[model samples]
Target: MTGWLPVAPCTPDGCARHTGAVRAPLPAALLLLSGCALVLLGVACIPLVRLLGAGPRRRLTRCWARAVPQAFGVRVIVRPHLPDGAPDGVELVVANHISWLDIPLVASVLPGRMVAKREIRCWPLLGPLAARGGTLFIDRDRLRALPAAVRDIATTLRSGSRVVVFPEGSTWCGRGGGVFRPAVFQAAIDAGATVRPVRITYRTDPHGSGLAAGAVAFVGADPLAASLWRVVRAAGLTAHVDVLAPIPADGEDGRRALARRARAAVLGPGDLLQARQTAVASDRANRPAESVHH
Candidate 1:
């Protein structure tokens, strides 16, 4: 039962790792205006995109998604874990939830149907656009609605379309992430779709650095405007979308086990060790004082 959506303990004050260097106020304002304009253009045209064929619409979506980040001065790098490159098949793309940028970051590389919370349907500009873009809405607060949602995802996957889901169900700071909720994995198993684990990490510099960019994180009650402004002002913001190996849809593996395997893949290649340390430390710091003593 998914009556209770998984929530991250991360808060902007406690976990957001902001960049030390920032763009000048003038340049940042320019980037912010450009980013907002691009987003508005994309959202306003969602309905009109239906005039084009499915293939063309998908390409446009990917292009727009990629352009938005660039307008905001955020560099994106997509890495393929396998030698063959990103797989072409019906897949359930599951990723570690981080910033709001995670959605477009994934779409730029692996365009597909997205599974999102139903509440998004009411968000101002982007909400209606998401609905028109063929997003699958899941009622995470309604336990009974989950079964039907899973069935719908399975049906879509069966129709040979890829589906992207943030199985963590909530946004976490890039320094850490919540466990991947197993409910969505059921849809992949039901549809016999390969599970593609993706790891999205944000850094202050494009070149690999130890500093995690919390400036991009959208967690807890942080206002969207504030997060967006921080992103546009940040200096040298970079996002890495690492496409981990694909996990087979083994009917024998229950959703829980399948979710574990997927999470493992996303955290593999030495990431899990660092992630475990960060997650544990973050969790401990965020824990209630009473619980910390206990």
Candidate 2:
């Protein structure tokens, strides 16, 4: 709920042209059903995870994550530029928040447990599915819960498992988002884990208008159902994820510094340039038409 809420401006006729282009009811229904089936399949496999251990559980969860986006007609493109000789031990994967799709987008390629807000735990079927997938929920509204959440994340990393955290704390339009919160970086420091910064941006097909046509962003106050509908109905949506070089959580860098560096990497040149281009295009599209004289 950090970025602009209203849809971008349309033409003089007052039609929400851009919005209308992305709303396909039939496709939405089909995509929703497909996503539900995938979730149900994951739910059914939950019992086996306990018996088989982390390896099987992670693999199953990864498959479910990868399929969810495909169900919604969203493709994930990974651009990894990891440093050579980086530690392959436990990792803390941090990325920018864009939409609920972000969960699966990140999970699909980089398999790991996620650190999500506590509200996700009460979202009906999704709640149980997330819990089963090894998600660690935190009550962001409560300051007292910070230590406990950090401890849980550290413990997970110390166990040689990767943990994903959205340091931005809230969702935003893919063009740009809020600053990264530094509290979670303590987990990486505590566990002596490497912090991997991943940048995720959304774009539409070349034949379409641009990223806005894809309508994958879940910003502002839009309800979950409505957002999901827009995503399912969108055409040629693609999520571009860039996994930057990993930063060491050594004594030289503290939690605050680590968070700053992570944010800088995630909001690198490519991301900033794209954001500016999107903003400029939006401005041009929203401009009023000049009246012609005889």
Candidate 3:
């Protein structure tokens, strides 16, 4: 659990365990059956949702979003704090990236269009589904494409729709994440929207104990299939989504300042403490191995 580990093949006896972890992987059959059922249900409802208008489509999308995580045995807990006089117009939601699960976890509470990497737009069934759910894809590798992506996001916001963006640009271990990229904040500035910072942290307990659990992060070089399998097998996994007070992106406020404030809100005092604890634990665990090597 100190670092990323390879997933063991499933067997009748059960998947192999991390040497010092307390939980055992759940059976593969259970995950497969639940996954299949969820997929079939989603496919059957696609046509129905498509027939509806935008408002109804978004509502149904929220229902399905909530259902998908439950199918994987993960619960989404939302803590929304909105100050009085908060703007009711288009809202731009910015959050930390922890795992692929962050999508459904956030969607379950706040339904909106997502800004995702262009690669996700071609990922088999998921790609098509995401497009139908109103995801805006951006080619993060191409610097030239930034203006267009920003324009699209601004347009979506101007149309009275919510848009979610992970400014970190990539997933990371749940303990902490990379710096927030300020480019996406330009969209909020351009649209004169309200930016709401959301903090997403995973836990192994229903009541989060302020610890960021590693079991829920999709980090390192793990394949999608392996991460999905691990998620399905994990028990008592919970996602904590904290929606901080909204910040207005007036014309006067620079995008850099907006990005800094948003990032600080997401990585608040509580998160910093949890990160420190995780670093200390990791250091202690590595000491024995270092001594043996020496």
Top candidate, metric TM-score: 1
- The true-structure Cα RMSD of candidate 3 reads 9.1
Clash pairs (backbone) in predicted model 2:
none
Number of backbone clashes in candidate 2: 0
Predicted candidate 3 versus true structure: per-residue lDDT over 117-153, tens digit per residue:
7778776556667766668877655556667878888
Cα lDDT computed for each candidate against the true fold:
0.75, 0.68, 0.66
Q: Give per-model CA RMSD.
A: 5.2, 9.6, 9.1
Question: What stretches of model 1 exceed 4 Å from their correct place?
Answer: 1-3, 81-88, 273-294
Q: Model 3: how far is 19 from its true place, Å?
A: 7.7
Residue 73's C-alpha lDDT in candidate 1?
88
lDDT of 2 by residue, 104-175 (tens): 877776777888777788876678888887788776555566678788889999998898888765565655
Which clashing pairs does model 3 show? none
lDDT of 2: 0.68
Clash counts per candidate, in order, are 1, 0, 0
The estimated TM-scores of all candidates read 0.88, 0.79, 0.78
